[model samples]
Target: MIRIENLRKTYGKIQALCGIDLHVPAGELFAYLGPNGAGKTTSIRILTGLTRLSAGAAALNGHDIAAQSTAAKRQCGLVPQHVNLDSELTVGENLDLHGRLFGMPAATRRQRIAELLAYVELGDRVHSLVKQLSGGLKRRVMIARALLHNPRILFLDEPTVGLDPAIRRRIWSLIKQIQQQGTTIFLTTHYIEEAEFLADRVAFLDSGRIVAVDSPTALMAGVGHWAVDWVSDAGLQSAYFPSREAAQAAGAARHNGFTLRRVNLEDAFLTLTGKKVATDANAQTVHGQGHGAHAAATRNPTGGQAKKGH
Candidate 1:
């Protein structure tokens, strides 16, 4: 479980988080939705102790994040937005190293490695070097490493970023399995549908502040059931309606590029924040659109996988 109250963070003149307050119950999958600089990663960093908060209180499970840093950290696992697995190491080697860092016993590490490799369906890649594996496989390895300690909560910041749709779904299924196993999951993603499909509740944040939080269905319903999109003087414009007949009526009177579709979580986010989710693909056109590289950086400037761990 995770809880926050009046969470605020600042970097000199820039305010990254402003009075954020939220709660995620145990075994629930909570998605944090926002565009770039919307405080998604900043909030994740603060929760994971990678970045400190300026003023606020946060707790992981039952431990105070500030006053009980070690215990709080031990309560959660983080899979960063970018891939951080060492390319030179084999899949098994990468996981083994993570276990060692957690001070896991040799026998325990071996058992956990075997179990997780099968859980992620990467058993055959046990000896395969990380560089030789596909992007999807590498991501599975990241999840395995993050779960090595079997923490009570998981923090996934853009977990499916940069992957193709098919591979992204595989990761989504894995995340769902983890949640079914009773791990609290806190996820941040630019892919609007990903949140809708995977999250039990969604929160929209803008300019470092939380604007709305609710189930994806409730949020979408708040706007309307249908959306009519068409070209306007201001370029692309969309209108929301409570019924398909209303949207169809509007579409009949519109010019080219008119489309009548069900309103989505993206519509809810756009209504609340006036900004679109990060993606070259239109989030409104389909139900399962992924953002690819428009979602998150695949690697650091060094052209290598960056490091992320406890």
Candidate 2:
């Protein structure tokens, strides 16, 4: 339901997008995975008519974003990174206000607000002020407000960035439910696990261009090698091969028996970008704000900015 071709955006000397080309099929949950400044937000802004493109074109539900700005926006819902709701407003009031802003009929707004509150599990707290809610609750309220108009496509920017593990999983399940009902979801997130679970297809961006776009399984397979590890007399010897069978063959040639384990998205990420991230639990974290992976000079169409992190 969305198409972008050679979409370019420049802010004076800073080029946020470098002629990106992408397509999202109707009802697909597509994830844009990248570091902070990789132009994920820039792309979303342009698609939502918040930012103008310097060149190329983008359309939502077959309507050009630039030429038919209002129509394009009407078909889309956005949950931005920052919370923008009035803290003093009650949950119900906030949703009601947004529904009114969208010009939804009173009867329709009432029904949708009820459905949205229940969907977000905030039905019991409809009368609670936004300022009185917890971090997770506030986030849910934001989501409900976005759904007030029931747009065809939903764009979420770092939806679960600061939530705890439990709340994050809850939101993940909620997103899946939304997708099951046939809403096209375009999401940007720092959690690789979230992308693995939610995205039907993922586009990994670096330095304003897509390095790879495919199903998660296909992307993992393209990286090559199973990445098994075992402590032996050699002390952490690493090997690379064309496939798991080859890696196993090399292992057999060197050792009697070794434990083999499957690799994950983190391994694929490391192979693609060649940088190791540090998470709190000793496991690798996703990229931080402004961490640029290797940029292919050939991929940039405009080459407008020197380099800036999102």
Candidate 3:
């Protein structure tokens, strides 16, 4: 339901996005994955009509984003990365207000809010103040508010970022439920496992360009048939062939303890980007941007819940 052709975005001297071409089919969950400074959010913002593109064309449900932004955006719901709800308003009130903003009538708004709160598993907390909700609950509230308009497409940016495992699984199940009901979900996330678990197709972005795009299985297969491993500092090496026939043909070249295991999306991501996974929990500095307020400000817009809609 989303088509982006040669999309580019630049900020003065820095080219944040360099000609991204992506296509997300209707009712599919497509995940855009990248590490820090790889332009995942830049692409998402353009798709959501929040950020203007420098060059190329993009469309949602065949409506051009630049020429028909209103119509295009009306067909999509966005759950931003940061909290954007009114702290003073009750959860139901917040959703009700958003429904009205979308021009939904009071009766429909009430019904939709009820359904959304239930879908996000926040039915009991509907009467509570948004400020009093847990982070996960607030995130669900943000999602409920976004769905108040019943957009055909949904844009989720790191929807499971900081939640604990239990809450994260709940959110994941909710996303799956939405997708099953025919909502085309386009999401950007740093979590490779999330993409592997949830995405119908996955795209890897690096240095403002799409390095690889395919099904998780197809992308991993494209990496290669040989699985090579080298032990750290010990010079221990191994190579496993895909089949026994192939291994026998190589004779002495084959080694034991090397099973034919398929590579995953993470392997594909690292191979394509040449960057190690950011494993340090406190390692905040990213792409030369320090781990301070400046970095936080300039970080990918998908870092947290920032705004509601365009």
Q: TM-score, each model?
A: 0.90, 0.81, 0.81
- Deviation in Å, model 3, residue 96 alpha carbon: 1.4
User: TM-score of the candidate numbered 1?
Assistant: 0.90
- Give the distance in Å from residue 15's predicted Cα in candidate 2 to where it truly belongs: 1.6
Those runs of model 1 whose alpha carbons end farther than 4 Å from true positions after fitting are: 255-257, 282-310
lDDT of each: 0.84, 0.76, 0.75
Worst 10 residues of 3 by lDDT: 301-310
Question: lDDT tens string, model 3, 89-191?
Answer: 9998899888987889888998999998888878998899989989999989988888889899999988988877678778888899889989999988886
Best by TM-score: 1
- Quantify how close model 1 is to the true structure by its C-alpha RMSD in Å: 8.4
How much is 267 displaced in model 1, in angstroms? 1.0
Per-residue lDDT of model 1, residues 58-114, tens digit only: 999989999999899889889998888989988999999989877789999999999
Candidate ordering by TM-score (highest first): 1, 2, 3
Candidate 3 TM-score over all chains jointly: 0.81
Candidate 2's residue-wise lDDT over 29-135, tens digit each? Answer: 99998767879888888888778899999999999998898889899998988887889888889999989888999999999999999989999998988899988
Ranking by lDDT: 1, 2, 3
The lDDT, on a scale of 0 to 1, for candidate 3 is 0.75
- lDDT over C-alpha atoms for residue 80 of model 2: 84
